[model samples]
Target: MNSIIYGPVPSWRLGRSLGVDLLCAPGKTCSFDCVYCQLGRTTSATTERREFVSMARLTEELKEVRGINADYVTFSGTGEPTIASNLGQAIDLARSILHLPIAVLTNSSLISREDVRGDLAKADVVVAKLDAHSQELLRQVNRPMAGLMLSDIIAGIKLFKSKFTGKLCLQIMFIEANKNFAVEIAQVASCLLPDELQLNTPLRPCPVKPLPPPQMASIKGNFHNFRNVVTVYEAPRPEVKPLNLQETLRRRPKL
Candidate 1:
C-alpha cells in the first residue's frame, strides 16, 4: 500500500502530528482556492462529498505505520478533509486502530451542512478556519466556490461549537489584504465561543507574506478577552522529524 499515514511533522499547535490524507487527489483539491494556500490553487475544488480515498485503503495503510511515534493523527492533506464521504468512519476506525488522538483541519465551507458538522465532531480536535468577516473580503482572500456565503459559514462554526464536545480551535489566517479587518474577524470568532482561538498569518510557500510579529501582536490585543487565545506567530516549536522529503514537499515545504 502507498504511504497514506505520512508525517510526524512539526505543527505549532499539535506537537508531532502524523498526517492521514483522506483526499490525496492528484493535485490541490479544496472548496476554496485560498490566496495564501501552500499548494497554490485548487484544481479540483468542489463541495460534493465522495469516496476520494476509501476507508479500507486508509485502514490498510495505517496498519503499515502503526509503529511510528506520533502525537496526533491529523486528517489533512491536499484539500478539505470534510469533502470525503467517509471522514467520520475514518476517524472512528482510526481511533480503534491507532492510540493517538485524531484531529481534523477543515476550511469550514462545508460546516454549514449538518453532515459535515457531525463528521467533524468525531475528531478529538478540530481546527476550523475563518479568514474574513465580509463577503467581499472572503471572496478576495478565500475565493470560495460559488454560492458559499460568509454568513452561513460563520453561523455554521457557531452551531458546530455549540454541539461539539471536542476541542475547537478557530484559525484566522491574517494577510496584508485582510489586516484592517482583523479586529472584526476576532469579534466574530468571539461569538463562536471556540475552545481556542488561533490568530495566524500566511507562513508557507504562498505568494503573500506573513504578517509581522509586532503587527500580529497588536491584533492579538483585541482577542485578549477570549481565554485560551493563541497568537500562532508566537507559538513555540520543537525539533521534529518529518515523514520524508517527498511528503514534506507535498504537504508544506519550508521556504
Candidate 2:
C-alpha cells in the first residue's frame, strides 16, 4: 500500500524533513495553481475543508516511521494542507507519535477562515506563502481560487500572528512577475513581524526559470530590516536518504 508518510527528504529551510500528507489525493489538489508550481497545475481548486485521509490510516503510517530520522514532520503533500478539516488533530497525533516538531506549509488563501486558522495554530512552525503584493499580481502568479482576496489574506496572517506563539515564517516566491513588488511584500512581512522571512525562487524544474542569485540578492536587500531572512540560493540543504525513495520523489522529485 502507498503510505501517507514519506520522506526524510532534504529541505533547504527545514533540513531532513519527514512529510505527512493529510490530503494524499491524486494530482495537485491545491487552492492555487502557481505559475511556478513544481507539481504542475492544480486539479482541484475549491476551498472546502473535509477529511481526505483518515486518522486511523495516518496513525498506521506514523507508527511505521516512529523512530525515523528527520528534523521536522511536515504537513504538506498533494494540496493545501489547511483544506484538511482534521489538520489540528493530525498535527497533535503526529507530534505525540513521532515526537518531532510539526510544521505546516500553506498557501494563504484559506488562512482568512477562522476554522483554518484554528487548525494551523496547532503547528510548531507555519510557513505561510506571500507571493504577491496586490490582487492583480496574486492572480498573475499564485492564481488563487476565486473569493480569495489579497487584502483579506494579509489581514488573516496578521491575525494569526497575533494569536500564534510558534514560529511564523513568511515565504515569498519571487518570479519575474513579482520581483519588482519585493519592497511592497517586504513591507507587509515587516508589519506581520514573522519569526523568519524566506526569499525563494522556482529552483526546481517548472515552467518558469528561477531568478538568478544576483537578482535574488537585490530582492533580499528590500528585506534588510528582517532579522532572519533566508534566501533559497544561500541556504544549505542537509543530506538525507529517504526510506522510500519512490515515495519521496512522488512529491518532491529530482530536478
Candidate 3:
C-alpha cells in the first residue's frame, strides 16, 4: 500500500509531529509558491478544494499512528491542508482514533471562506501563516495564488479568531523581503490577536538567500504589542537528526 503519510519529524516548536499528506503526493500540489518554502515551489497552485484522498483510506492510516508516539498529528504536507475538501472529515477520523492533539499548518489563504473556517474549527490547534504585512511584501514572499489577496487572507484570519475555540498560533516567517516591515507585521498580528505569535526564519536554503535571524531583543521590543509571543530561529536541534533509510524502515516496520 502507498503511504500517504510521512515523518514523525522533529519540529522546533511542536515536538515530534506526525505529518499527513493531503495533497496527491509528497511534492505534487500546493496553493502558494512561497520563496522560502523548504519543499521548494508548488508544482500546481490551484485554489479549488476537493477530496484528494479517500476518507476511508486516511482513517485506516490514522489508526496506525495511534501506536506511534507523536506530540501532534499535523495536517500538512507539500501543500495546504484546508484545500483538502475532506479535511473536516479527516480531522474527525483522526480525533476519534488518536489521542494526540490535532494541528494544521496552513498559509491562511482560504480561511476567509466560511467553509474553510468551518472545516478548520474542528482542529485542536491552527497555526496560520502571516509572513508579510503589506500586499507588496506578501506578493514577494508568499507568491500566493493568482486571485488571492493579502486583505482576504488577513480578513480570513480575523474571522477564524472570532469563531475558533482552539489554540491559534500566527506563524511569521521572517525573510529579507519582509524584514523591514516587521513592525507593520506586528501591528497586523496584534489585530488578529492569536493565542501565540511564533516568529521564525528560514531553516533551509530558499529560492533567495534567507534573512539572518532577527535580533531577538529588537523583534521582541517591536512585536511586544501582541499578547503572547514565542520566537523560533534556525537553531540546531541537538536531540534530532534526519532519519536514515534503515531507521526510517525501522520506525515504520509495516512499510
Instruction: Highest lDDT: give the candidate number.
Output: 2
Best by TM-score: 2
In order of listing, the candidates' clash counts read 0, 0, 0
Q: lDDT tens digits, residues 1-255, model 3?
A: 346566677766677777777764545466788887766667778899988889878877777667777777788776788889989888888878877788998989998899999999999999999988888888888888788899999998998899889999999887677777888898899999899888887655456664555465466667877777776664333344323334333233110
**CA lDDT of each prediction against the hidden true structure:** 0.85, 0.89, 0.77
The residue pairs that clash in candidate 3, if any, are none
User: The CA-based lDDT of model 3 is what?
Assistant: 0.77
Over 68-172, each residue of candidate 1 has an lDDT whose tens digit, in order, gives 778888988878889999999999988888888999999999999999998999999999999998999999999999999999999899899999999999988
lDDT of 2 by residue, 58-158 (tens): 99889989998999998988778898899999999999999999999999898989999999999999999999888999999999888889999999999
The better-scoring model by TM-score among 2 and 3 is 2
What ranking emerges by TM-score with the best candidate at the front?
2, 1, 3
